[model samples]
Target: MSELVEIREDAPGGPAARALFDEYIELVRERLSLPADFEPPEHIFASADVFTGDGAAWLVIFDAAGEPIGCGGLRVLEPALGEIKRMFVSARARRGGHGRRLLRELERRAAAAGMERVRLLTTVVLHEACVLYATEGYREIDRIQPPAGPPEIWLEKPLYS
Candidate 1:
């Protein structure tokens, strides 16, 4: 069955927001085959705070019944560049275009906020995510080696192009 998905902007610290983020982390850890005791880096967790500031936005996608099924955030990294962070759709919500919808919405909001480009990073293990980003016009730029955690593939897309 097709479910109606609605994206709503919200504070990253809300209870529902925290729950969705926690779920996203667990899914990523499992998909990447991380150790059972692996913990996400502090910087990654702290980055959520930036979404609560100016030129930034946090979005939660809700199902028709008002249940959150996905979440993402856009943060202005520089004068005209924004970054997509913490983007995820629940397992049950996959392959239904919800992810693409969330991504497009984020990009629209970014453009409306005067952003000229958007960048994001994901691990090589997230094959589906990598493919989605690539198919959506994001080009791989470089590999980022975080202080702690697996290396990440960086991708960027021009908003106006």
Candidate 2:
């Protein structure tokens, strides 16, 4: 299964990226029970220039037939620190080990960019994503209760330790 997949570094604004990101956003919105027109703040959603410029990268995972199935990004928060942003795998691609593979690739990308530790924020509604992070060695550090909606979970993992 792993052998049939390929992870490639790419721009986050491409067609494949657009499709994957749209699917990901919709899934999160539905799980959180938000209205169709709801728009999360930029900080909570897309951070500007995150997958561009220095110390940041976006990746898309492709299946054997060359269709994008999963995507993720690494954005530097500070010196030697990066955040895992927009990690997602499509519904049809779940449980195929693609998420884990995509995450590992992102970690490699982070290390190459000189990051030592990585952090990510996820909503409690995303059970599968939370489980994937835990299984990938990300430990929960904080649970933040927003004024509304489910609590957001913050997790951290060190690339070197």
Candidate 3:
């Protein structure tokens, strides 16, 4: 059995965390065959940027090998709301309930941070992720075609009363 691990949020910008974040992005791009222009924003990857009063809080989950296999974050948009961004789980780690765990953890953290609800944007091409969010109680709020790309769907869920 693979050993589940607990990750600390204190070292959110450390080397291991950063490397895993990069790998997670790469996996998504490859698996989804996303357009070249669909890259993640650079601000989230820049340690200084993510922490500089920005709307981001990074989290990572490591596997038995002490490798980060999953990650996501709560981007505080307001005192009672947050945005979930960059959620990813490696192929090898899927079907093991890690994604659900990560999602729950993120929601808990957001609630602890005083957020009442959390939201996220995702592409239709990522069908699995969309289904996962829906199953986890995220309701679709909108779908819009951005100026530079395909249509994106917005989903939101309340984390607290």
Best by TM-score: 2
The 10 consecutive residues of candidate 2 with the worst lDDT sum are 40-49
lDDT of 1 by residue, 1-161 (tens): 27787889977888768878778778777877777676667545446678866779999989998888888889888979999988888887888888889999999989988899999988887777888898999998999887655788889999973
Candidate 3 lDDT tens digits, 110-129: 88878899988887867778
Please say which candidate is ahead in TM-score: 1 or 3.
1
Per-residue alpha-carbon lDDT of candidate 2 for residues 51-122, written as tens digits (9 for 90 to 100): 886888889998889988999888888979999888889998889889998888888888888889999999
List pairs with backbone clashes in candidate 2.
Answer: none
Each prediction's number of clashing residue pairs: 0, 0, 0
Cα distance off (Å), candidate 1, residue 144: 3.2
The CA root-mean-square deviation of candidate 1, after full C-alpha superposition on the true structure, stands at 2.2
Question: Which candidate has the top score in lDDT?
Answer: 2
lDDT, candidate 2, residue 16?
83
TM-score of each: 0.89, 0.92, 0.79
Better by TM-score, candidate 2 or 1: 2
Clashing pairs in 3: none
In what order do the candidates fall by TM-score, top score first?
Answer: 2, 1, 3
In model 2, the number of clashes is 0
Q: What are the Cα lDDT values of the candidates?
A: 0.83, 0.86, 0.73
